[model samples]
Target: MVRSATTAEFRADLHAWLDVHEAELAPTYRGMGTLDEQIAQMQRVKAILYEADWMRYGWPERVGGLGGAAALRTELGASLAARDLMDPGHFSLVEVLAPTLIDFATPALAAEVVPSLLNGSEMWCQGFSEPETGSDLSSLRCRAVAEGDPSTATQWIINGQKVWTSLAHFSDRCVLLTRTGPPDSKHLGITAFFVDMDTPGITVRPIEMINGVREFAEVFFDDVVVSTDRILGSVNGGWAVAMSILPFERSSCFWQRIAYLYQRLQALTRLSEPTDRNAEIIGNAFLELHALRTRSRSTQHRLAAGATLGAETSIDKVLVAAGEHAVYNAARRLLHNTITLDDTVHGEQWRTEYLYSRSATIYGGTAEIQRNIIARRLLNLGDER
Candidate 1:
């Protein structure tokens, strides 16, 4: 059974716990740590929080959770982001993928696998993106065919490729989507799976980003065999799972990221010595962050109230991209020559963040796609596609 707590009560309890455990939960990465180190730090935090039961709240008992309101989990993630205890990007993936597993996976499968993820014993990646199917994911061509006797246990043979699979090299498993029907089948014929990353015929090659970080990878599956139990949802009904994961990614993930961005914007303000001319720029950036926070809070409440978030979440995505770019642009503006030429730790940090900020528009659906969603779905302008 699920438990409920008033917002004030939950906040007071959570804050007291954080205060007592701050030292243990703090990120231990030294200056300029790689993505691997960041991920390791995230795992340490997750392990500690899970053991302490904070990580296990807001999840179902079937998945080894205490079964509280989902808002508690989102609040914990947002708190971690605010405190700089973890990378919100890596942390958001769990929010995005785990619920789908719980909702669609068999009870036994969810119970067995969800705890591994919640406690940080394993990492998982979403294998939705392909070389050709970035935003048009319904048209993905990664193939998986069932071959065997109809009565006996069936095994699926998978083939094709996935690109920009974040943290694939480090993931123990991948929630993969594949084409199960003809090319024109599109959304109808797609299927999803939870496959072990080490399965035979699977290969992962990390892709280096412009910031010289290999945070994503290209994954190739050639005749990979998976049991029927590995299927996430009904055969050829995987699009439902894929579609369901998006709201969590867009809203829950957005809340945590907004918290992180707000912290960074606060830090920028404190560290910056604003000129009269740049005051407007800084103010504009701060306003954007505030607007994003407000918008995201409403979305979070809607989620907590059990409302189904749909294409309208593209608004949050758009706000997030704008907020990120504005703050990073403010950093460049404030730091000026120091950001452009200095190689000091602070300067490099700023530089790396600035470069990474460029991708805010691209990841999780591009800005163009987001605007189209808002125009059509939210504003009812017209059908976009």
Candidate 2:
């Protein structure tokens, strides 16, 4: 059995390991690459980390992890992001999806598949948002119906569309949400599934982002037959699964994103000349980033302590979006012509990142929606209007 270590011990050990293996883990292409290339690079890095046992820390033993506190995993991701070894967004998918699987899927199923995801042998995508149901997840229309008697059904037929599914084209499986109850049942009618991406009747069409990468995809499911054993959590209990995911998305995933933002801020400082305007911009951005990091750290500890996170995480979401915008906005202002018109590698990178940052508020629950959540759920204010 792998020995458990405190956060400090794990950090020191991981940093030393990274320092020694930097050459083997570093990406061949930096700052500029297609989405596929970036994904490949992330997988390579994950494979090496998994072999070194770093990726397994903080996860449960049942899921092939080393069974340390969840904070350990966040630190690993942060260290990687700080060193610019992996794209935090891509590296964070596991943090977003694996926990849901472990909590909701059957023990056997989780044990069988979570290891592949952890070890970099396969990639998975979350299938939640539909074309018409972005933030209003309760109104999703994806349909799943049992092909046999409800009590003994062995298969389910699913037909629906999911948009904005990150990394769908490269995924081996999907943690999908479908409406299994009456048409208007809303949240109560939903069910979650562990689906094979290669299953017949499933199609993935990549969508190119403003950043010039196909980071998102539209996934279509038509008459897709899935085994009953693939069900995650109780039938028609997908809302709970989705709720569980929100906290992780808003908190744990942001740890690495925060590290990435700090790296960008450092780069912006280095590229721009020392001027009052640049100084003010960087300083304001730094403050926002620091606030986000502090809030996110508290959330991580709450999660590690086994607290059930709910509307409280909306605050984290709002802060992270704000911090992301601030950092990239500063980059746009300081980099000036390079961000606007230059075609050099550094210029392209700044431009691409700036464009992508625009979606930070929109993804993982929009800033407006998060505010609504905070007002209605957290603050006991009136319903969202």
Best by lDDT: 2
Candidate 2 global TM-score: 0.97
lDDT of 1 by residue, 1-385 (tens): 1233765676678788899989987766555467888899999889988988888888899899988777788888899999888889999889999999999999999999999999999999999999999989999999998887523547999999999999999999999999987988999999999999999999999999987789999999999999989999888899999998987887878889888888888878888766776788789999999999899889888877888889878988999999999999998988877668988777777788888899999999999999988888889898755
Report the error of model 1 at residue 365, Å.
Answer: 0.8
Tens digit of per-residue lDDT, candidate 2, span 115-205:
9998888999999999999989999999999987856899999999999999999999999999999999999999999999999999999
lDDT of 1 at 63: 91
| Overall lDDT per candidate, in order of appearance | 0.88, 0.91
Cα lDDT for residue 234, model 2?
Answer: 79
Per-prediction tally of clashes: 0, 0
